[model samples]
Target chain A: MIKRLTYGLVALLLLAAGPLSHAQETHTLRLAQTWGPNTPILAETVQHMADMAETMSDGRLQIRIDPANKHKAPFGIFDLVRNGQYDMGHTASYYYKGSIPNAMFFTTVPFGMIAPEQYAWFYHGEGMELMRKVYEPFGLLSFPGGNTGNQMGGWFRKEINAVEDLDGLKMRIPGFAGEVMAELGVAVTNIPPGELYTSLERGTIDAVEWVGPALDFNMGFHQIANYYYSGWQEPGAEVQFLISQKSWEKLPPDLQEILRVAMRTAAYDMYIQSTHSSGEAWSRMKDDYPDVTHRTFPAEVIEALRAATDKRLKEVAEGDPLAQEIISSQRNYLKQVRQWTNISDKAYLDSVAGE
Target chain B: MIKRLTYGLVALLLLAAGPLSHAQETHTLRLAQTWGPNTPILAETVQHMADMAETMSDGRLQIRIDPANKHKAPFGIFDLVRNGQYDMGHTASYYYKGSIPNAMFFTTVPFGMIAPEQYAWFYHGEGMELMRKVYEPFGLLSFPGGNTGNQMGGWFRKEINAVEDLDGLKMRIPGFAGEVMAELGVAVTNIPPGELYTSLERGTIDAVEWVGPALDFNMGFHQIANYYYSGWQEPGAEVQFLISQKSWEKLPPDLQEILRVAMRTAAYDMYIQSTHSSGEAWSRMKDDYPDVTHRTFPAEVIEALRAATDKRLKEVAEGDPLAQEIISSQRNYLKQVRQWTNISDKAYLDSVAGE
Candidate 1:
């Protein structure tokens, strides 16, 4: 009887402490990213986020990431996460525009707000609420993953001095930007990333629009393209992180907050990293290819591109109430925010430009 | 005998789980901030950081914040944290320049890089290492707290069209910028924040250099001053978070990571919030105070200001080798990064300006 009583007492003590100690239960979440293995900034952001989460949770939360090469589905991350095939995914929202047409607004527009302004829209304006409305129905949660800053227009063999210069010009551009290009009488082509360099070099494509200098440095476009034009499209291209509701709900509150903060920090860090690497890469590009020059498309060309973009946006907003809501929210927010930008950073930059 | 065996088994089990379960221990840290109670963005950032730390640590780590009113030491946060009166502090690095002269560089400089470029320097370039060199000897570790974005020059009663206009002009400017103004034949005065509005209205000061529109909106300077000039000084004014080494060392690895990340996220969030609020406030200022006109100093004035700034920087870099290293690093890095900014975002903004 004494032995049994002692055993019962021990069990009761262990039970009393169990809830408090259960935080030690470890959870490992599987993540899939659209970028391939060892992709510089994008892949590094995923790793950074995972490291932060693990360290902050004392190894109780672990994230196992599979890049596009492992998953063999670069553009299918949306379905993968929504169906619970993976707990989380890092990919661009615009990639899913084929199935969800309104998704492109969240990634970027042809002539939208830049990174800081767009971030303000997301966090302090109507963006998060609209984003929630878009993702909640699918049992998925979406958050901004990273930004590429302001993307360059394209690497061109010749300067675009007029609207007529785009007439039948063979350019390898993609997404909504490509659609706007097509509207302007350009021969917009989709080339594989592997073939882009050869295509531009062999004159199969007269211009190629990759990301800005950091990623573009690897593509070797500067070696062949003498003129790099400033961009009107994809002002701030924000990639996204999507999580399955089931997986998110399974984590305890502390771990959930850890994941949220880790992802947010990683997103901001990627933008800063992009800024750093782009600076370094641009400097190297100029040193190695002294003949390369920077140009902005002429007023005529910019005007045409802007008009085409506005027309496409109008069409996109047609026949869909939620799409119209998202579009108008961003447009109104940009109008107010851009005025501030013009008065502050833009004015300051212009004033000190001669220096 | 049975009872003894049972007790031994329970003891072994508890011993095995001791390290894992020890995470249940809780710690509370006291933080002192430079802002008074209910201060808008600055105080909110402190609260946001503390909330995140608590949530992420599941109450294992709690941060109790004491604003300036509670502590009665607005500019003495560095000393407070250094003496262990407070475990942490949130204040501008430059506020302690009287005691730590080299500390001002970590905040910002006249005609320095903007927010994104400055952030690149801090995270990717030599900023963090140089910062460590500055703060390590003081037994405190510092991190970027928040940014006010690109600060405006000031609210001016009259427009400044040329360098001659600065002659004998009385301005309520502070810090190194004031030194630069004094070099340009301007009368620089420091007034209490509460007295600033009445002084400016009564022509005690011809210009009042407060922060940008967001913080400045509350001061009602727009009602008195007609011209709001773009900034030449403190382009990206970043405040800092300081923690005593003893307090930092006492926390476990997980809680430390939690604190670091919480601070980082809150810092970035504050910048975005500033952007949002500034845009909102600028719009309202224009609507309510239609006489408030935005202006940029002419080329002559800007050139003179830049020259004065460069001269001051050289003097500061004279005897201090560490200051020289930091100043040179920032100049060289800014040269490279600003070139990237010019070619990418600036060029794009200029191209689309007519729209």
Candidate 2:
């Protein structure tokens, strides 16, 4: 009788404890990115974001940032995060053109817009509405996580004296630049970021364009390339954080606010860090590789490349539904802004050049 | 005698550790920002950057992200970070017109090149170099960060059916946009971001144009305004991150590399986060405030706004040495690209609008 009564009491206690334990639930977010432990811009910002959440939330919400390889392959980051295998990820929209064609517009467009124009369209114009339509089916929500204020023209083994130099040049490039380059008779290739150095080192690729001096210097581009060209092909490549819909939906309003704050902070600080590091790297490269050639693209060549980029971007925007919405809104804004820039941006440049 | 000898040995060990403990490598970074926690974009990014250095280096490189108030105020973030009071910060170049009026070119120009064009000039053209020259005197480095893609025209108590609505109206604006609005006969007020909300809410301002639907929704502008319009004043407002020279010099080469990678990751991710959040926020906003009326600026108003923006930008760029350099390099590339975008961007947009 005593044993039976003890068992009954224990069962009751267990049932009572289950509700209490369930009520005090904790959440874990795993954010993935396609970079090594040392990549400064995105990786460092992510780590900082995770730490801030943990500290500010008082450990109630724990976020673990799984660097490029820890969780899965680098390219798989967006899919993994989107499919709910991971809670979140860091990526550039152009990286996944095959899966999400419309994403390219958000990441970048050839001759479409710069950082400010892109930000304005998405943040203020109808651009964001189109973004959700693209992401909704995939179960992801996106945000502006990083910006490489207009990028470099790229690194080249030979001087780009004319549009002819681009012909048959095997260049390591990404996103719309590759499409634009391909359209212009250049052999454009996508180099998963990690391999940019080895490929450049082995001459597997004759030319490449990465972020800028800051990223280029750290990646040791100066060690291999005899020349470091400007990155003009796709100015202002925007990067993003892809968060899982399931994870996003689960967060309380306050946690969501915290995430927004954390992401923005990461965005601002990372920009400074890159600019600082890139500038130093530039100085260091000059000091170390005194023979490294630095030259701007000829005016004619710049015009040709820009034309080709625009031509290719139009091909995609007109055909794709999501791209149509985003590109149209952005392009309208761009055209309107362009007329004014003819005076502001162009007139100023002319004045400076004359000086 | 034995106890005294043991005590002596322990005391000797303790005394020897004193200097080592007190002077433990001594690495601390000052990260400054022109924002408070309430302004999540850059402030949060700054916080993450600091946390990353600490975590990655295992506290060898300690970085503290200081809010604007911690220093003299928001406007001083650039100077303070430059002066080395703080190692790094996120700020808009236009905020401190007094310190380096030319720095405004680095942030943005009214009617300056679109996103891609602006980026091209800065990244590929000599824009970055010129910007560095301007900021270097102040001992700072600036990184391109969050861009408010085409900003919304603005929120007003009344709809902007014509340009006359702007006449004598007090508008909360800054940078090149404010100048353009002034030219358009609007009474423009340059209020720091912190004070914008109260100024607009209390009727100190007649109309206000901030980022867009995403940020605008959170800002609760719908409660006070009946009409929301398109982005006209600022096509793109590019923000930047600044770092101190002294703080950057102290890092080892390897840590420097990490910083670069971190910045790249952070900027890209922030861009994605902001864009995605804005989209979701815009869609969900109606559910929060059904009365939020979204209206496009009339064609005449847009044309006038564009004309005025262009005029003001030209005046500034033509007169300013740094602005001219940025405008020249930026527009040179943009001219080439804009031709192609004519068919590519504009044609597609025309088709979409027609459809």
Candidate 3:
């Protein structure tokens, strides 16, 4: 009789302990972000993700984020996560092109699809599968962190009416776009971002390509340049969220789903936030500086730029089968998706644009 | 000594039951959706939301969705949820305009913002606040469920060349756009969705306004109608998720967050899916039926439609203060955001449109 009572007591105890143990089982993740502490939009997105994860998990999941200043490796997020020093990372994929050349395709390509179209590619097309193929080898997982929408080509002091206008033009346009410009006979140079405003104002650089109006507003580029041209390069620049496979596997299934959904929602939210802020900033820029007119490159100049971009892409794809596969996938997907964009949003925008 | 032993036993029993009680706590909510069972992207979005909610909460919070076929109320989702017969609903807000006049603004206006732009307004600008004011009285909380990107205006047998082309034209267009068409001297009528194909094929209706290619492809419209006009009526038609205030209050904070984020992510996913499906469907349509051509209404006809839409909007906002506030907010937000759209995506699309 005593043995039976003891067995019953043990059964009750196990049942009682199950809920408390699960409820109290908290997992904390350390995240490293490329942006400095309290950076707008970018860092905000990371915090937003962490907040949702924590709240949705009811304190079961906690993410402790270390920004660039804290981590002291702004562009080294991929390495940090890969080496397991950080559980997660928020950084643009293109910044690590030197380490992994194929990483650039995940960020954005010159003459690529816009934000929604690119997102469709990522979620519904071969983007996620292709991304998984690239990152899986390194024991890392990469997801789209956020987008800056379509970037402006640059703020220029003079108009480019023809292809020749690009020749010998001293412009601070970095990355693949700069290479394209270099191929078009332009003097492409890179300058420290902190000095870009002064460089453009003092004519050290005749033109500068920064981000869209939201980030650019703080740079005060509109105050210096009168012509704000539309972009060809980085049509939808998507940053990435990198996570170590070991760290991801530590969490239970429920927490894993929570983290994934939180990151996805925060990424989409950041895109919308970028859209709102850009609109507000552009409106303020136009109001403050009426002379800052929106312009597009002439068809002749655009065609030359396109040719340069295609040539550069071909060279990048040479000899690397993975690079070639990614390039072809994006090219074909863009071709199919852009047709819908042209007939829908583009057609609607064109019909209602004059107002 | 006996009393002390009894007290110890009671305390131990309570401790044993604590975890089991909490672990067994589960809440189930019944949701009624406007779409029929297995309604492709629309129904898929609701199921996605439910699956996320269930997985993230470890089945603590469960949503049981009832499609229109089960509930027998395609347009009465709001009423069903409001009356507490259903704990949640997935339907367009505008479908209840007869009962709540201000609800239409939540879906889409005649020539308002597109998907991303509208999402920006809803999340960042005055949209959520205005929506709260409109919905608060109903004891309901509504969120954006999903979006059908920029909708196609309709399929037409003949190309619309001028304003005169619309005169006395019998078109099956519904809701606010139908009212606007009537103002343009078009004999606007409503037809059952099932009979739409035959009506158009038999020339009973000269034109028909359906959804974009994804949904339209199934209706067999493209095979019969060669002219697919870009949309003006519903730039971004967003469906809504409705919850009873009581149902929301019953959820724990964590489960509530799970539901909210799941709905949000699912909504954005649906938008992306629509984009992907539309691209696929439109491409197939073009390849299979080479005679089909994408067309935008002539500028004169577009101008006439715009005028009629504006006049109707003015009438709707004339006496109602809340309606006026919502209308003005949308207009101002659209004006501000569309400039960015024009200069960004529109300019980029135009620059890279042709092969």
Candidate 4:
């Protein structure tokens, strides 16, 4: 009878241990990313976020990531997360502008604040509140997923010396920058990523504007196009993380904080990684093909581009109160912040540029 | 007999639950910070790190922070953590230059890579490895704690047009930069932080070097000295988080990652915060003090300062192989990275400056 009692007591202790071990229940989140499997920087960011979340939660919280190939919709991340097909997503916010016009601003705008400045706006200024207001209605949360640093203005076969040079310039510049270029009389075309190299090589396109040297080197745009112009459009292009409100609400407080901090760190780390990779790639490009020269649009050409950008931005902000609010807030913030930038980093850079 | 058996079973179950529930143990680390209590961004970063650690660990891992006032060893954070008096510390590595000369390079160097570039070096390049080598002998682990963006060159009472202007210039500039200045015939003196403004105002010092606008604005330097020169010294100054090896080994793998990611996010967040606050403060300074102007030292002055800095660095690297490795790595990395910077953000900023 004593032996029988001991066996029963041991079984009871095991049962009690299960409940006591985890005061909070475990949860698993499904994350859909815009990039394909093993895409550098962007895909790495998603994985980094997942690793941090899992490790911090001690496997109590798990992230099941579905890349673009699995989801079969690279640009459908926002919709997927919002509809609960996935608990979260990693994509650029601007890709969803068809459904939400204001989403584009969060990704980047022509002549927008650079990475650090944009981050400041999002965190310390009206950016977060405004971003929340945009995403809240859709029952989705948007976060800065990662940054690609300052993108290079596409690779050009010919140098643009004057505003007139833009006329009849066949380029594969997409989104709002394409609209601005169109306003300046450039023939802006959108080509599939796979066909870009062939098109540029075959004289099907005069210029191809992809990402910076890091991502661009893989596309082989430099071999055909020698003049690499610096970027004005999407100066600080930031990708985003989108989470379903349902998924967020289901998380325990600790898991919620873990996910939040994980995404934040991943985003910042990507920016640093981009900076490192771009530096290495650009250096390699210069060494491998010294003919690939860096150029900036002349003052006249820049003036025209800026004018077109301003006109387009104003047109977009016309009847949309929320859009106007965000635009004005960003503009005002940029005005104040750029002055500081000019006196600080820019001035310092200028002073040391000669060396 | 049944009642006594039931009581004994309950006691046994409770005893089993206690050990089984915590397969991973709880640990609380004591952190000593160089900043005093409530030291704005610096103090907030420490608290932010601790909060993230506690929340992510679900109270399993905790950090108890002690500010400088409580510890009375602001400059001795290295020694404190090394001796295991504090499990961790948040302090500038350069502050302990007298004891460990290599520690200063991890912080910032004169005309070094800016925040993003420096972060890239730390994470992607040889920075972490070199830093580990420096601290491993001391039996401590160091991580990047926070960044102060690009520090500004101090406020000067008059314009500096030529190299001769620095001769006999009584300035309150400390650290390696002070050594560099002294090489250029500047009478460099270290003043207590509290006395800097009065010293500048009363002509005890010709110039006062503080942090950038965010921290410097509060010191009332803008009211007295009008010329705020751009910084070449201590660009991208990063504070460090030091963990005692003893304390580090006590935590589980999950907690270690939690602590690491927390510190990284805090460091990046601090940089963004500094950018935001500096913009706000500089704007306020302009509005409140119309006479406060921004200036850059002329090419001759910059050249002289650069030469002096080079000479000093060479001297520092002369005998120490480790120091030479670090210095060479930084110089090479800066060369490659700065080229990318010139083409991207710098070019963009220059083009868009007029607008």
**Candidate maximizing TM-score:** 1
Candidate 4 CAPRI classification by DockQ: medium
State the lDDT of candidate 1 residue by residue for B222-281, as single tens digits: 999999998989889999999999999999999999999999999999999999999999
Give a tens-digit lDDT track for model 1, residues A294-330. Answer: 8988888888998999899899888999999999999
Between candidates 3 and 4, the DockQ winner:
3
Task: Name the best candidate (by lDDT).
Answer: 1
**Mind sharing the TM-score for model 3?**
0.98
Question: TM-score of model 4 relative to the true fold?
Answer: 0.97
lDDT of 3 by residue, A117-170 (tens): 999999989999999998999999999999999999999999888988888999
Residue pairs that clash (backbone atoms under 3 angstroms), model 3: none
lDDT of 2 by residue, B219-273 (tens): 7777788776656444456677777766677765535534543454355444444
Candidate 2 iRMSD, 1 decimal: 15.1
Lowest lDDT block of 10, candidate 3 chain B:
B1-10
Per-residue lDDT tens digits for candidate 2, residues A1-355, read 5556556545655555454344234678988888777786767778877766555443545787787768767878778887778998887777788887777777766555655446656655666677788788888888877665556667787677788878898888766777778876789887877898889788788888777776777777877777765545554467788898899889765456556656755654554454445544566787798877666666666567777766776777775676666767876766544433332223223222211
Tell me candidate 3's interface RMSD: 1.7
Model 1, runs deviating above 4 Å: B13-17
> Per model, how many backbone clashes are there?
0, 79, 0, 0
What ranking emerges by DockQ with the best candidate at the front? 3, 1, 4, 2
State each model's C-alpha RMSD to the native: 1.2, 14.1, 1.5, 2.3
* TM match of model 1 to true structure: 0.99
Model 1 per-residue lDDT at A38: 94
DockQ of each: 0.71, 0.04, 0.73, 0.65
Q: Estimate TM-scores for all models.
A: 0.99, 0.51, 0.98, 0.97
lDDT of 4 by residue, B216-322 (tens): 97899999999999999978999999999889998888898899999999999999999999999999999999999999999998898899999999998888999
Kindly report which residue stretches of model 4 are placed more than 4 angstroms away from their true locations once superposed.
A1-21, B1-24
